[model samples]
Target: MVKRVGIRDVAELAGVSISTVSNALNRPGRVSDELVERVRAASDRLGYVPLQAAQQLRVGRSGLLGMTVINIANPFFADMVAGAEDAATAAGLRILVGNASDDIAKELDHLELFERVQVEGALVSPFGPVDAWQERLRKRGVPVVLVDAVDDAGVMPSVSLDDVAGGRLAAEHLIRTGRKRLAFVGAREEVRQVRERLEGARAAVAAHPGVALEPIWTSTATTQRGLAFGDELADRRPEDRPDGIVTSNDHLAMGLLHGLIARGIRVPEDIAVVGYDDIEFAAIAEVPLTSVRQPAREMGRAAAEILIARINGTETPDLTNVVYQPELVIRASTSTAR
Candidate 1:
């Protein structure tokens, strides 16, 4: 095996002190540009890689940020992570991504790992209630910023969408199309987004006389779960079935549409479907689905910026909750039949 290159090798090659090479790598501005270039060139030639642990210990900061998501397979989170990466890179910081898969214990483990690694801050889209960890993190002097999650304790900063308004928009659109019976298809109601969206739908339904909104709760957020729900709804009597369905996400909406079509149901002719989180698939679906578009990329950028500000001590430590409004995107799925 080839011997690993060290700072001493780079210093010898550049004819400079080891401390000078270290300063060039960590605090470049403190050294002359010519010397910095010389040290960098020598380091590149020697294939020297600085030990991140030692550097972090010396500076008491890692220049690394941790981000946690429920699922990375979802396109919505992919875009958000891309945006976060761009923002983090522009700020000269690196991001460490962790997927919790909706497991609270795993999420806590990731948080502890980030703490042990000495990450400057964290950006997280929590899977469930995190009140128990708030004090633990605060006691350790770790700054956590919630992404796409609400700040209930008023301690951590957060960025999220107005899910209730998004729900109301979908319900109101269906009602305007002369649909009275409505159904909401979503995963567990314990999720804040799902719960808030249902609340908004309820508010809209209450405003219209004779309008009824049915809640179709699913344990899973997968496309198969949506297909099953749609098939069950299809088996109901036409008069008893809902004319409009609002899905929690675009993936579910796409699956429900497929199931409805397979059951010989015509969209808008018999039932109309609308979804939230207007992900990439929404536009390319067999029938373009009307959806509420969350500013996912913007949310990610905002979360990164907030975390950076917190790390740099440029912003107040008080909690901040910024909720971006969701926009309604109209498509063929919700169009009224002529």
Candidate 2:
């Protein structure tokens, strides 16, 4: 095998000292323009690939950001990752992603990996409590920004949707369309975002005197579970069944909607449905679903930008939270006689 060329080879070719070569390649601002150009030209000619890990260790910087998401299967999270990648690329940095799949143990393991890698910062979209892990990262000088979540103490910056507003919007729309008995189907009460949505729906129901709200708990927000719930609801008497349903996610909502339509239930006429995260499939499902739109990509980009700002030491005290309001997308799923 050919001998691997090192920075020393590039320095020799450029007629510069090893320290000058290092500064020109890693921190260009420390060297002159002519030296940087000459060093880069020599590096290109020699095919010298610097060991980034060793260089980062020497300089106390990695130029890498870490990201953790609850579930990669969700389209919303995927879109968020794309948005974050946009910002990371623009800043001349790279991101390392860890998919926790909604498990706290996996999430912890990812955090530990981030620590070991000496990431400059992290974009954490947690499924459960992780303040302790976040604190540990902070102690290690890794600035963290929350994505799709907020620190109750307002210490860490965050970019997220107003989930309570999203839930309220769904419930109010159903009430406007004359849906009285309504049910909310969601999973994982331990998740903060899901709980906030339920709180919003409950608030909306309480405001309407004649309306009644029922809460349904499930294992996961999957299409299969939604279908099962739909069958169970359709089997009840007309008077006993909910007139409308609000779901935690599009997957469950779409499945539940499919289940209802398959069971000879007239959607909207029988029971209207609304879902969250107006994902792409929500618009083209068997029955177009009315959903609350969360600007997932935009939220992710915003979170990454904030994290970059903090890492660069340019963040302001009040730039800690950025919350976007949810918009309702009305579709045939909730429209009458469509």
Candidate 3:
């Protein structure tokens, strides 16, 4: 095997001292432009890749940011990751992504791992209570920014969509469309997002005395679980079924739509459906889905900015919390017209 080239090789090739080569690679601002260019050219010519860990150890802080999300498989979270990468790159920082998969223990594990790795900061879209973990990370000198979830206690900075308003919008749309028998699908009590959305739907239903709301809980907020719930609903007698349904996310909505179609139930005319997150699949399903749009990518970018500010000691505590509004996107699933 070829011998691995080191920084010493670059220094020798560039005719500079080892310290000058180090400065050029680790902290370019400290080195003169001429020396920096020469070091870079020598490094390129020799194909030398500096050890990031050693450089970070010398600098006392890594330029790496940690990001923990509930689920990366979801298109919504995937978009969030993309936005975060874009923003972190702009800030001259790199991001390490971890998926907690909606498990609180897994979420805590990811946080502990990031802390041990000595990341400068973290952006977390939590699965459960975050203040305790936030405090722990802060005690270790790692700043944290919450993503797509709020700190109701006002202790942690967060960037999230107003899920409650999104829920209300979904339910109110069904009500306006003349569907009175309403049902909410997915287990909202477990996740803050779904819970807040359920609260919003409750508020809307409370406003209309005639609209009775029924809630069905699912084991997970995945498409498979949605399909199961939809199958169960399909088994019910026609008169006993809900006239309108709102799901926790678009995955569930699409699965439920497929389940309904398999059972020969016509969409909109039979049962109107509304889903959250407005994922790409929502628009292309057999029946276009009506959904509540959360600005996931913008939320991720905003969270990264906030976390970077805190890491740089430039963030104002009072302005740490950022909440974006949700919008309703109507489609054939909820409307008869194309």
Candidate 4:
């Protein structure tokens, strides 16, 4: 029978004590960087796989982390997950993800599930106020970090994009291109991101006197909703349609573009469109979409880092709120016709 390579072998190969090897693998941040690298290299070369059950027993905590998002189907959230996974793996931990699919009940259910499993920590991209959940987890001695949302009370750490700035960038670009009649398509005001974006767009329009922003509220910020809005707009008289449009996300904008083009409406020449998030599909659309880019992946990584620090009882000062700026990526969808 072949014997498994153990931590003792790794310690011997790395010229480190067993305690140093364990700390390097299990509590990387607590150990020196050079020693951690040496231990990792030795472990990799020896194919050493730590006994997870024994480690959990010894440490009194699982090696697993939990992440819940509003919708994993959305490319933005997908990117965030990738980033979080990368960070977690680097710290010698694994993540389990739950997709709420924008359901509050499901969101809570997932939180309960994570709690039942006793995750070391959790990162949540909550659909609504998470104070209750955060409190519940705190009582259970689990750390939680908010992803893509901010808690004004500052009770929990959070990482998010400057959505208002993204909205302003989208609106300002349209206005600069002489698009006077602009329309904003997004979900209800109850959604913080949508509300913030609309607020920013409104501010941008206010700065440009002649630019009027028409608010088109939807039940959901999805491709289907965007398509429905597009169809509705197509039925309107040409004179009544806005010259420029900004949707809350790339999927919605792509759907809108498809709906408009199918009805023989010329993009840019007639109506320019910009979307938020700058998702992957934005570049491959019939007419590539112009969009405001949010650093979704980086936000996820940052949120996970904060949660992990809290989980490890490591002091992280003044990192309660981390907000990233947005950038505008111009494409054919919003390029003005000569």
Candidate 5:
């Protein structure tokens, strides 16, 4: 077996002191350019990869920012991760991603892992209240930033969409297009985003007399749950059925659309459909979906900036809570005609 080369070997080959090699690798500005080049050349020749763990211990903090999301497989989270990666790269830092899968225990486990790793900071979309964990991290001098989740504690910075505005937009559009009976298909109202969205929908529904708003709550946000809800709605008497449907996210909307199609119910003709997140697949659905576009990438970038600022000893502005407005993307799914 080939043995791994060490920095000592590179230092010997480059005729430099171990301290000089360390300075060249970690703090290049502390060493001359000529020496840095020589050390780098020797390192390359010896195939020496710096020990990140040792370097992190020596520096007291790793240049790694941990990010925890509910669902890594969701396109919305994937887009956010891409944006975070770009931002972290530009800042000369790295990101460590973790998936909580919407489980409180899993979320806590990831937080514990980040604490053990001594990550510079963390960005999290909590599965539930993380107030206690936030306090523990703060006591340990670890900064935390919330992403796609509201920070009611006002102790942590956060980046999220104006879900209430998004809900109002969808409902208003449906009402303007003469849709009176509307249904909202989504996860439980306990979730902050879902609750805020429902609030906006209710506000819109209140403005127009005779307009009815129905809530179709589900325990899960999976496609199967959406399909089941759709199947049930399709069986409703025509007069009792909703004329328009607003889903919490694009994934649920896609499943509902498929179920509707399978039941021979034409989109926009019999039931107009609108969804949130405006994921890539939303536009590619059989009948291109109308959706509310969340600034997922922007949220990711902002979260990184906040965490980086905190890590760099800069006075992170007071728990900044950025709530970007959602835009309406009209497509065939919500058109007036089939």
Candidate 6:
């Protein structure tokens, strides 16, 4: 059997007594900052889980719900988390967020941590395939609600957006506004949501004989990367540049929009831009972004309510897959009439 890392290992690594290690970890106020840092460093080096996390739950309960998200930096996930908290608070339960940091390993770790903490239920917005990891939760009799992702097995319920429809809407709007050469820009093609969005965009492109769609794979979805893409787009000859652009999210769209504008390219007249996820900053951008609205908060609230119901064994409506349709919001970026 593999030996578990004990507190003694941490103490020895930190060059402190076991009691000091315990106090530093469990009762940090009782120890000096230097000692706490040393103990923490040692614990980290040994891959030691804190005692609270290491210990299994007691017979009673933790009265807490665990939520895991792909990336907390994205405002959509942040809004969703707030919405979940709203439901959790109203239900008299606290919540713990386990940010996956866009890594599958981290997501799996979050699931295991939730099990150890004995959370009443878990909300998972998966970053990658998690069929096997979630099976463990099911075997433990712990309720799980898939947030923003549907379970392909049809066993667990989910609250999600119709990304395909969203992508189609964005592309159709650009085509209707008289854009012929269009490009879809974003990263993480391996992600289901991004891939499905592309599927819809291609469908729209295929319907029109003259219109063409080009897929631009990015390294990451960030304003800085968008800026780079925008600069590159501007450097191309006017005839070679796409007339309309559909981005996976607003961060890239906004950045690309600015990059184009800074290079004397006229939006709508020369190139129009459409972004996904109408985040708060979208409406307030320098040119006011046009985007596809994903009901992030509502999706979050719905997922939490369902998970809470499952935890309390309360009755709820059929939520096998609560899908929300996306809405296209028009703004100055794509506002020009044909």
Kindly report the root-mean-square deviation of model 4 from the true structure over all alpha carbons: 7.6
Model 4, span 1-338: residue lDDT tens: 99989989999999999999999998999899999999999999999998885878576877888999988999999999999998899999899899988788899999999998789989999886786588889899888888988888888888998989989999999999999999999875677888899988999999988789999888887888877788898999998999999898888899899889988889988999999999999999999999999888998888888888887788368787899999999999999543
Highest TM-score, which number? 3
Tens digit per residue, CA lDDT, model 3, 104-179: 8988998999988899899998888876597788789888888998887876799989998999999999999998
Who is ahead in TM-score, 5 or 6? 5
**Native-structure RMSD, model 3:** 3.4
Residue pairs with colliding backbones in model 4 are none
Q: Encode model 1's per-residue lDDT on 1-338: one tens digit a residue.
A: 98988899999999999999988999999999999999999998888999986787686878888998877776788888887888899999999998877677888888888988888889988887878577788888889989988887677899899999999999999999999999998886777888999999999999999999999888877788778877987898999989999998888898899889889899877999998899988999988899999989889988898888888888754436778999999999999542
Worst 10 residues of 4 by lDDT: 53-62
Report the poorest 10 consecutive residues by lDDT, candidate 6: 50-59
Query: For every model in order, what is the number of clashing pairs?
Result: 0, 0, 0, 0, 0, 0
> Each model's TM-score?
0.86, 0.86, 0.88, 0.82, 0.86, 0.82
TM-score attained by model 3 = 0.88
Q: Which sections of candidate 4 miss by over 4 Å?
A: 1-58
lDDT of all predictions, in order shown? 0.88, 0.92, 0.89, 0.89, 0.87, 0.89
Model 3 regions lying over 4 Å from their true place: 1-48
Clashing pairs in 5: none
CA lDDT, candidate 4, residue 101? 86
| Model 5, runs deviating above 4 Å | 1-48, 315-319
When superposed on Cα atoms, how far off is each prediction in RMSD?
Answer: 3.6, 4.0, 3.4, 7.6, 3.6, 8.5
Leading candidate by lDDT: 2
RMSD of 1: 3.6
* Two-way lDDT contest, 2 vs 3, winner: 2
